[model samples]
Target: MSREHWEPVTVFTGGLKPLPPEGQMTGMYKVRRDTPVFCDIEGLRGDAQGDRRVHGGPDKAVHLYPADHYTRLAELMPMASNLLLPGVLGENLSVSGLVESDVCIGDVFALGDARLQVSQPRRPCWKISHRLGVDAASRLVADNGLTGWYFRVLHPGDIPPDGALELVERPSPGMTLARLWALEQSHRPSVEEVNTLAEAIGLATQWAQRLKNRADWLARNV
Candidate 1:
């Protein structure tokens, strides 16, 4: 039991494919699954990312973009409304009743038999622009803090089709993904705040290091 009660709206998985005219590969075109999917330390079985260097890893194993975000996304980019849907952004799990501001960085949840920890907020990239066919798609998500969060598996198991995520622990209640993204977007965020956020429990190593670097730069330059 926790902040929001949410059942898995859908689970998605897909392999790499040419993005567009340029033929750049991307795995953002995930398809919804009606059957149970195996959750491993690496990720859901059959899930693949075009870019291993930045996309898939132990720290970024599973991605969840709240289904609630699509409405807001559509409001911001009406032209791309047709493309706004759960799993379209490459998320593995789609659920309602939860958004960025509702969960913290170190929150742990149990979905079916698997346990997952919030590792980092998903970073919006140009892929969103390509996926949505809107040049400002990525910027809109980033600027509005609509970017969802990622989950790193702690216990691998089968996630049933109708499974729900139940919050089991919250180690960094003050470090919500929304707050982290806001601080990162701030032109002159406090160095102390940045440093503290960099050390937030359960945050991804890459995200923590990036925050630390930002903190240092802010300390020296601002």
Candidate 2:
């Protein structure tokens, strides 16, 4: 029998609080995407907002993820759920099974009532390690890439507490954890190298350039 590989368990959200509050955040959270919230594309479409709040909406940006991200990371430690806390993200939206990091800029998934379009990987900050713990928090952003991707709301609505997630399409077709890691082999990737590699995977031209730029910077500095 085919085992159930991935399943979104829950979607947690911080009602309305400080985005990334400085401290252990508890309570005042909502079960954002449990077995219900369906994701869909709406509002902005086919654009790279990076770390800007252009994906979800002008007021509230949403971080959607599959549950496996937590189960796996939580496997590392219990308190890691501290990151899962709601107001910690001012509002979080968790899911089960799929690696949130694996979702790249442009990938699409159907939540419950709507769909979500991936914008970019979440760049790790010190706070993450603080929430998830030192080692895991540090490695999560760098290696796992399970950083829950952002989505632009094409449909205006809320993901009810009984929706299922569906994989519509991947934004970066060829961009996977393994492929993206290949860019770091030399510790410095050239523009041509970055462009060719990223384009090979169906990455948007501009987004490819952005990644290439990151590699170039890494190469020059590190």
Candidate 3:
């Protein structure tokens, strides 16, 4: 596909405050504005991730969610439709055009002056449901494979809110985000499938290791 087919970033967001507590869970959920944000190997310079154990790392420097998905989600879960706006999902970049099916692991893109590579498909967590006040939202994301993807910064630089993201390179033996999500959701992926996923280029090291571990365990069990 042509680079012009790629989506343009609609909003860039970051938050200095923490997400308000609903029961015992709290985090930085409200990301605000289309400001100039600095993207380093770690993540957005000013952005704060409340739960460091599950977020904000070199491999997941930026979280991107497709703008189109929001409408579908709103229709699916009308109870929390008001909360389905940009940045509500704790994503740093909201873009149009590219969704999970279109993006592949190891695909590199140029966002303004910064270079980033697709790292992994986001594994939805309870935080999503907590944020939306809809207990089934996270499960729906996982089941539907509508969860967005993350990116690892290759070259740090300034990225404006309206910056256009263009594809730079795509690795061979393409593994699309949707495919990965399906593999993850499988009841029991074959050992060979796990091994293949672990060996895929452009996948984050952590995910590779997780797949490798699963393969090893499956081999031993079988």
The top-ranked prediction according to TM-score is: 1
Q: How many residue pairs clash in each candidate?
A: 0, 40, 1
Expressed as tens digits, the lDDT of each residue in 115-184 for candidate 3 is 9999998888887887787889999988888899889999999887778888878883457888888889
Tens digits of per-residue lDDT for model 2 on 1-222? 111223433455433222234543332234443333333342312212223332334222455544555555665656655565432332345555556434544555555556555544444455456544455665654565545554555454556554555667764655653445446434666666665555543343445677777756756775
- Tell me the tens digit of each residue's lDDT in model 1 across 71-148: 999999999888888888999999999999989998998888899999999989988898888999999999999999
**TM-score for each predicted model, relative to the true structure:** 0.96, 0.58, 0.91
The top-ranked prediction according to lDDT is 1
Candidate 3, residue 35: how far the Cα is off, in Å: 3.8
Off by over 4 Å in 1: 1-4
Please list the C-alpha lDDT of all candidates, in the order they appear. Answer: 0.89, 0.48, 0.81
**Comparing candidate 2 with candidate 3, which one achieves the higher TM-score?**
3
